[model samples]
Target: MIIVTTRQMQQMDKNTIESFGIPGRVLMENAGRGAIEMLSEHFDLEGARVAVVAGRGNNGGDGFVIGRYLMEMGVSVSFFLLSTRDRVQGDAGANMDLILDLLAEHALSQFIEIPDKDALEAVTEILLDHDLFVDAIFGTGLNADVRGIYRDVIELINDSDKAVFSVDIPSGINADTGAVCGVAIRADATATFAFAKAGHILYPGNFHTGDLEVVDIGIPGHIAKAQSPHIFLPEPHDIAGLIPARAFNAHKGSFGHLLVLAGSPGKTGAAALCANAAMRSGAGLVTLGVPEKLMPVMEPMVVEPMTTALAQTSSGGLDAAALDDIITLLADKAALALGPGMGTDSGTQELIKSILAIASVPMVIDADGLNCIAKNPDILATVKAPVILTPHPGEMARLTGKTTADIQQNRMETARNFAEKQKVILVLKGAQTLVAYPDGAVFICPTGNPGMACGGMGDVLTGMIAAFLAQDLSPESAALAGVYLHGLCGDLLAEDHAFGFSASDMVAGIPQALTTLLS
Candidate 1:
């Protein structure tokens, strides 16, 4: 599903209103009606008292529409306008007038104007008496910190312990970054119009967004397509479609061979996990290449993957002398998984540079492999094949010469800018793993959990991506599928246990994850 930024969504709304000729009021009505439907589905509206806390904006206009509908349905409704009746202008003011007319005719509902803090305090007890709170104060345009009576109103609603439903987005949540603006309403659910915004899926905003329901507010498909949203949330069907069907008559050679260069004296487990995960992810064959000193250790640890011993440095890492042998080993390989446990010794770094200079297949670089390149990132420019860099925040920070905080603060931009500039597929692994392409398109993986935070998890991911590459999936498909599957595995384990599931456990769960995804 395409995820839009606030600006893109705004442009889409503008295009629909001005170009497609859908009036703003009609859209607002549709949004309000859809939100009411969602609320009815989630909560018991019969004999319910709903407080429609509204601002003097289009979002507030949506609240007015909802309140009018609620009154028509025989539900007790109250409108608490943050601004005075005259100050409510535009479509919002018009809708407020309609609500006023309905109330004047029937005297069924109450309309309270609390434009200042004193009025807000005067009605504080009345506000908490409602069965539900409809948050329509702010929408996707919120950027700065929320303060004044607006803050106090949000706090009251949050403390009310009543079922709160947000409109478009939760009030006081930054619709673009998902950052909390001072304080935000933790809604029981949020009804977003047209499409899910970036804030709805990203970080803290997602936490506050609750059970999100995307309401079709009459935005034309052509208008949405014209926006050309580059960010996406990968659904199960999308990832399932990427997996190639296996041939009935195929043998080991049909799937493709994966060559993994990993392992050091103490990090042999990393290589084992990578090679094992490759086999689990459907690689035809896997060859675990390690320093000569670790051969005996790796040979006994792994059963399916064949192991090759390369020349070793004094520190027991792959040596620069192993370059010729490593290149020869890549002759029949389908893809390369590099830098999992490989240390950053001088010889190993040289070996990494040498391999990149001459390798002729797709490569999934991670861990120390990424670290080696961070020392001389320009080596990525010299590569001839499709390369996927799997970097955690720290590694990404090192590669870009920025702090880890900087990378985390703006993960989307950081990933997109780096991928576009470097001309490589970049997987920024974290909470919502991002798969960024050289063309600037980014896909967010919503799978995985905190339990997968343990060591060797990324190594498993490296193997998964390399296996997909070996299966003839494009660099983009491999990265997207791999990240999604990796997270799904963790999620599957999380269903049974919250945390403490190891990377080995994740590897064991790969087939089950694939089954769950494809089935």
Candidate 2:
């Protein structure tokens, strides 16, 4: 599903209204009717009292339409306009007129205009009496911090403990960035028009936007396509479509071989987990390459993956002297998974740079492999086959020289910029893991849960991507399928236990996830 920014959505809406000849009022009606349908699905509206808290904007117009429909259905409704009746203009003003006429006709419904704080206080008790609040104060255009009576009303609705349904987006969220603008309404559900905005899927806004439903508000499909949205939320079908069917008569050589360079003295578990996950993800053969000192440790830890010993530093990290051995290993290899347990010794860092500069196979770099490149990020510009860097916020921060907080705050922009500049596939791993391409397209993985916030999970993901690349999937397909599958594994585990599931447990669930996707 394509995800749009506020600006792109606005342009599409404008093009629909002006170019496609769909009137603004008709769009507002469609939005309102659709929201009512969603509201009925989520809450019992038969005997419920609904408070339609509206601003004097198009969003408020949507609220008026909802109130009018509620009254027609014989549900008790109250229209609380944040501004006086005359202040409403445009299609919203027109809807206000119609709703006012309905208010005079319906005996059970009432219209209250609270343009100031004093007027709001006068009806505070009345506002609290409703069982549900329809929040239509702010829409996708909200950028400034919310204050004054708007903040008070948002706070009141939040404190009401009543079911709150939002229109377009929750009030006080930056529709583009998902940042809370001072305060935001925590809705029970939100009915977004046309398409899901970036705010709806991004961080804090995602938390505020609960059970989101995208309502078709008469925007032409061609108009949306003309805008060329680059961001996407990959559904199950999207990931499933990327995976090729396996041949019935294929052997080990038919699938592809994967070479994984990882491991150090104390972190041999990282190497073992990554190598095991690669085999689990369907790699024909996986060779676990570790420093000579850790060969005994990793060899027994993994049963299926073949283990090899490379020259090691005194510190038990892969030494620069191992470059020739690694190059030999890369020959005829399908893909390379680098950096999971590799320590950041001076020799190990040099060895990583050497491999990165000369290796021809596609590579998925993670853990300390990413840390090694952070020291000389420009090395990414040097000779390289397709490369995918899977970096958590800390590693991403180091690569870009920004704080982790900064990276998290601007994940999409940061990932897109890095991928475009470096001409590589960049996977910014976190809550909604993003896979960004060199062409500036990005895919957001909507799987995984809080249970995935443990060690060795990224190592598992590195192996998955490497396996996919080895299986002849493009770098883009491999990254997308790997990220989605890794998250789906965690989600499967989450169905049984919330947060105690380990990375090994997720690895164990890969076959089940693949079955679920393939079936």
Candidate 3:
């Protein structure tokens, strides 16, 4: 499932037309038919009126094709042509002519041409008298904020009580960034072509697009794959495929071992959550290394995991002496999950820097461990391991010294840019967690709900990624699978609890969530 930018989508359409020999008109016909099928499934009208607010773009062409099909099916479709009928050129123009020709005798009674705002309002009033509204005013190619007649028409639809089905994408949404250029149509459902546009999944767009249905407009799979869009929307089967099924002869050694350095005195809960999550994520062996002083307190908390007591400072945090023991401990560990309850004490930061200096395996850095790295991020440039940094907006702001507002505003660019610069797998965790790979691909997760907003979520996510990495998943796959699993688990928990659910509860639901997916 590749998510394309507006430009990329247009390029794909152009390539199909020029290189692949698929004419633009043929594609437009298919696009229209595809959207109409989706519309027919949800809306049934033997003689009811359907209002189509059409523009001059291919999106309007799609609406024209749909309107023609509906009219052919014995449904009354009233077309409100925004621009002059003669201005519609190409396949869109042809379709508009065909619709008019079909209703030539009923032109005055069926097709309504509105060239002004007053006429548009009169058309909107007529549309309100109908049962369904088809919004084709604008599409993915819209780059600037809409105004004048078009904006008024979109507002008219929004104010209408009719069920609105947006064709392709809702008008006024920037297809690549999901930024609302101006007033965007709040559609009840959107039937998109081939794949979902990047804007369709991005924040405000996600909320506006009620129910999304991606229709296959008869594009060949190979051609679509050739587009090489750098974004992916993770699916359940995606995670299910990456998680290896255990062989009958598999043993503890078959599953990789994980080494987790976490927990301070008062923050021992973070360590417990991190280590427990690793085991729950199917790590064959997990070694929880904590300050020796907290070992007595942490030992009982983990039933299946083994605990190691390391040197502690007077502050009851991990000390530099633990570095030697950590090196010796890392010999057979397949992956390492650092941070969590690890405090930002000067000595602990030294330990983090020391661990990174020597680590050869993949590592997931989170929580205060990220805080330590933020003080001197250049250390990441020297680490030998494949590092995955999972940072929240605030942590990301500190790591890059950019305001949280900057990070949140352009999450995809911020994370991708930082990941490319730092040469690490960057997981910008927030409402829609973004996974930016070293190769420049990014995935925005769709699973999580508001329930997974409490403490220890990142710790659980850190452990999950390490578990996947230990199992031999590629860095991209591990981050993608981990984020998907983390959110899917949260979504499952959201069912039983209120919107204000806890991250700990979501952690408890991980095994159950995976079990459901596997089954």
Per TM-score, the best of the predicted structures is: 1
Clashes of each: 1, 0, 0
Question: Which has the better TM-score: candidate 1, or candidate 2?
Answer: 1
* lDDT, model 1: 0.92
Q: Is candidate 1 or candidate 3 better by TM-score?
A: 1
- At residue 63, candidate 2 shows an lDDT of 93
Q: Residue 315 error for model 3, in Å?
A: 4.1
**Candidate 3 C-alpha lDDT tens digits along 133-196:** 8988888889899998888888877887678889999988878778887889988889998789
Instruction: Quote the positional error of residue 30 for candidate 3 in Å.
Output: 1.5
Provide TM-scores for the models: 0.97, 0.96, 0.93
Q: Ranking under TM-score, best-scoring first?
A: 1, 2, 3
Lowest-scoring 10 consecutive residues by lDDT in candidate 2?
221-230
Instruction: Give one digit per residue, the lDDT tens place, for model 2 in 187-248.
Output: 99999999998899988899999999999998988888887637899999999999999889
Model 3 quality (TM-score): 0.93
Give the CA lDDT, 0 to 100, for residue 242 in model 3: 86
For 430-466, candidate 1 gives per-residue lDDT tens digits of 9999899999888888997888889999999999999
Which parts of model 1 are misplaced by more than 4 Å?
A: none
